[model samples]
Target: MEPNNEKSIGVQLTWPIKQSSRVPTPATPQAEDQKIEQGSSKKRKTSDIWNHFTKIKDGATTKAICLNCSATLSAQSNAGTNHLWRHYHRCKSEPRQSVLVPRNSQSLPELIRPPKFNQEAMQECLVEMIVAHQYPFSMVEHRSFREFISALQPKFKMIDQATLQTECMNLYKKRKAVISKQFDDHPSKIALTLEHWSSLDTSSFLKISAHYINPQWKLISRTIAFRLLPPPVDANVIVECITDVLEDWKLLNKCGSITAESSNSNDLAVNKICEMLKERQLLKSTDDYFHVRCAAGAMKEIVQEAFKTTQEAISKLRRIVHLVTATEASKASLQEVAGNCGLPSNKLPSRDILSRWDSTYSMISDALNFQLAFEYLQATQPEYLDCPTALEWLQLKTLKEALEVFHESVSSLSKTDLPSANRSYLNMKKIERHLSKPEHYENNHSINIICPMANAFQKYWARLREFSEIASVLDPRLKLQYLQFSLVKQHGVLVAGEKLTISKNRLICPTIPQLRV
Candidate 1:
């Protein structure tokens, strides 16, 4: 085999080269030149992983350090840039900085900046706070309130009282425009509730709320007007005010019934409103539209009278509650006793507001629930001098039971979201049944409570025929049968039949003998 120079050179080229002791410096200029050339040839792609590694130059050596993990790797070597690629891949495989220990505080970047105040959103929040909480417009000017808002958002500029008032009026006007449009688009008749309130300054205001059924059969209610009534409020003045509101909303002809507290002035107002409507050919007569009494007002009257009968018992319970809650020490002692007897922590007695019968009932009921606690306190504590006697507690129990019926009745009729008018007669009937039978009472004390309540209800019951009875008779669940039965039970068969005939005629319904039979 003769030596061939071409074959020898090829064999030598195939042999591996020995590694150099002096590593090649990272090709700075070459790398820059290569990068520029590559940039021209191809579009540069950016990635988040590239942000963590920073290229560092030390004398002639070049290396990469991960900003997040602080891992260092040689960038220039005889083996080439494979170490830089491996280091980046390993650093990316490691957990993200946010998942690891927080980046060194000194090196951490600010994550959040102060936000600019959104005036519209802030204005809406202020309006909601005022409306929902019944806060005065000047509340925003309160130092404490301003400080609270500042704590929440330091950059927010709060409105002054004058600006707040202007915003309130603008909001009202905007809402009125929306509601007026709703009335115009509504397909059903609107029922209204009128209330007159007098302030301490003797300024009178007439509030009117509208209720109507939507196309979806949902009952919707909204307060439409709260207008100041000039001095000398009379039927004509009230009628004018109401008409203006109704006309403003284009609801004068669409009005159904107007409910107000049973008062001479309100009755006259309703009559006058109907008369004006009739003159305008909007209604046929005053009777064409119903003038209903407030069911809650009637119930309040009944409860008020019923409360008078148990005033002595209520007063004693009130004194006991007062003493129990008189001091921190007394409350603590009472809590201790209550806990010992396994009584609920909330079973502590409550004080009653003389004007509100429901509060009176709560006082008595709470006293009854914590009867053992009261007894224990009476025996042990010398300061609790006005504790109720055994007989007094029995009276309180009786009073509570009797008052519960009225409370429940009032609650049911006060549901503005539901059709309470249709159920008025049924609720009245339930109240009557509860009071009618003396056998339901365990003692004469309870009977005494029932008598006055029954009397108060009877007074209002007779007036139900004016409107509520008509609603009851029209209800599909009760129909004419309930009216006939109720009438006969109260006013005998002959009168019941005659009254039914008159009611049917008024309702423009055909007389059916079965209703009378």
Candidate 2:
């Protein structure tokens, strides 16, 4: 150690050493050139850090000292040829220096580096997006959503059609996010986030703008929240744009530019993107995200079910009907209360008392209407079923299991938890006794008998027609009635025969008397 004076020092290094010095061996022309190139890449040839900031050429007589042993060496004669020979000769007599270590670029921080996001990681993420987000792998090339991100982070070696889809999807999602966050932040503000934020391409803008044109009110905002919003929604901006497009349909007719073939591959994707954006209330009016022409062909359903225009009446009705039927056929959800902890559904007055059954009934009824409508339209017009009795039995089993779970919950609770412990205890005892009795006496199977199972097909079809016509105004996309006639042929007639087809113009009310083919 050196004295801790003004120039305090430890193990020291200097430019030149007084004692013997050794140099590297000279190389052939090819090797020499490579050395020169390597030397040039470093600021100081003997530096530990690797850097290619500015390289010194092979012919240049660059000189530097080994920072380790303080030995000076020159590129020419003294370093390798003459000096190396001296070192080789002296090495047999004297000990060699042991200060050299491997060099790395990390030693210096100013070097140009690769991006932060991993290329391989980005590629894997994109692949996952295709598999997980219901997008096709081919979309990764075409959509800007994927394309730009990919360009920023090239996941694969060769980007194909996915590039286009990536671009398209990325742009839409970004735009939607921007709009969604903007509107969600200032929910009551009329100034909406523009669907085509001047930055979007005009060709793709058509698709992006479709939702703006034919907006789903529920998705845009909860009807209550939407109503609270202030006027104009950038009234000056949207009203002006809307006026411009409505006045000249050509301005918005760019939808024609997107050919059917182009849409086929991407329709599901587009619809989903639009739906997600709208559901989150990301888009504002005058955006025309879906470009849906007003359904002026709405039926009388608009009056009875939906508040929308009469033209959409028929379509909305079909949607409501399907909604009902879905609940009925959702075999997973239908439950039973029989043999709960020690309580029997049949023996207990619970069904007759019906405390919570109304909610369930309403739910089932609504679900049944929607569900059966979807089935009826599918069946009479297309092909459809009452699930087999075995399925019904399975559903019953599930109901039984649910009851058992409930009983377990009740039994698990302490007696102090009950309002009347003695009464509850007796009730539990009675329930256990009743459930233990034979199944036939309690008439558990009689439930099916009580239910109207005779005209399942006829009733299912009739319910569909009713709901489709009535709910058409509520959801115009449910033009199941229109397509229904394609199956149930002949006007104002109802029959359960095979291959039923209603005429296109048929509009029979479900409440009306049945008509035979």
Candidate 3:
């Protein structure tokens, strides 16, 4: 009987299930299979239901929580997630109350929305307008510009002229800082070209441009200073200004040379700069390598002076070109004459610029190429008043040939990208040899023209050889041979040997082994 009571107790325990807290249980296999089948059936259509609602488990029920309002909703299998779509639409159309949280529960912080005006985009546009185009700062306050900005971005605030000026100055400072850092880090010596320019308003400005060889062996030029100069731009003022700029860039010791137009003030400025360098111990008292006159400018002055001797012949040639190209009728006549002379029909005589000697040289060269056409025109047309005479033509030919040498030298030395210093002495020597030709001296007209040019060239030649002999010696193509030959020509062989020995002792012997004779 007692065993029977135990069985009854077991039956009673089985009948009364133990009460436990409800937790979400995993779905049964069959339910999962049904869900998979339903999902597969709906896979043909893409779903965006996740954008507005998040899936969440509540005990045994699968629910979707609205992202906008935090409203909890049960998902129905028959309707799929359509109920959540409707709830989202309703919440968007009609603003819902913020979800209240329990006092002890934690909630996420609210998101902060961006302002309607995009300040950064507007500022960038402002900078581009002012800096890139060099637009005046007052242009920012222009009514049309303001309207344009408003049309582009209605809520963006427009900046004033004062504000734009400040921005420009700040931008300049930032750029200057970057350039200063580059100058400080450059590995090669910095060559500078200094010039004083007067504006139309009579305001003077000192321009300093930097030239250096980059790591890739390419020459680079940049304008480092274009500052307004105060009154009395004397040698001392020029020296002070240049020194301040060089010191500002920390380039005093790194300076290779300072080139300026040939002027007494510039010469004095060079002397002062050399003194300053010596005072700073950056250059020795005997170092004269840091000063160089502008080669192009020197050549221009020499050519201009030499051309003055042949003004009569050059004037006749210039008149001939002007007459031929005076009118369309004259041009047509010249063309017909050219065709008959077996010359190029379309080739017209070039006009020369009075200030540019190179242009004059080009005019002479071109007229010589069309000599037959000009001669034909002169023979047939008696009314051609400025026709060049035979002697004038001969003069033109000799002048063209002689000036060709000068033109080629100027062109080669004027190039900014090439190393012209090493070739300076060699070029001068070549020109000297060209002028010393017997034909140039035999003809009276040729001698009259060549003597003065030779004299002017010699003056500049001596100056160049003095400064550039060492540079020539340094060149791989023209080593000590060029220097010795130049010295032997200028001085005797005994003096040449003594000068070479001195040069070797001062320049090469200290840094390199002595060369064998």
The best candidate by TM-score is: 1
lDDT of 1 by residue, 130-154 (tens): 9778888778889999999999888
Worst lDDT run of 10 residues, candidate 2, spans 293-302
Q: Residue 364 CA error for candidate 3 (Å)? A: 1.5
Q: What lDDT tens digits, residue by residue, belong to model 3 across residues 1-517?
A: 0112312221121111112333222233334335445654554432344555677877778887766667888865554654554565457422322333233222333342223466866686687777899888888788998898789888788888777778778777877898887778886567788877887787889999888766776666778888888887788888888988998878897776788877888889988887887798776565555677676667776777668877887898898888888899988888888888888876687899885799999999888888888887777777665667888788788888888888998888777367456766767777777888888888788887788888887776666655566667767888888789888986899999999897776564331221100
Show how many residue pairs clash in every candidate, following the order shown.
Answer: 0, 81, 0
Q: In model 1, which regions exceed 4 Å deviation?
A: 1-126, 133-161, 196-206, 227-244, 247-250, 286-289, 332-346, 370-397, 440-447, 481-502, 509-517
RMSD of 2: 23.9
lDDT of each: 0.72, 0.32, 0.72
Tens-digit lDDT track of model 2 for 1-517 = 2112345233232222323353333234334335445754543233111110112335556543433333445535334433332333233222233332224434435554333556555555655566567776566455666556657646445456646467557755555566544334432322111222122232222112221111223223111111111232333333344434423332222221111111222334334434444455543322332421111111111111111212132223333334323654422122221122222222211111112222222332233323333333345442233321334333333233223422442444333332211122232323333333344234444333212222222232332333233233223554554334433543234552232333222334331111100
Error of 3 at 85 (Å): 13
Clashing pairs in 1: none
TM of each candidate vs. truth: 0.65, 0.20, 0.63
- Model 1 lowest lDDT segment of ten: 9-18
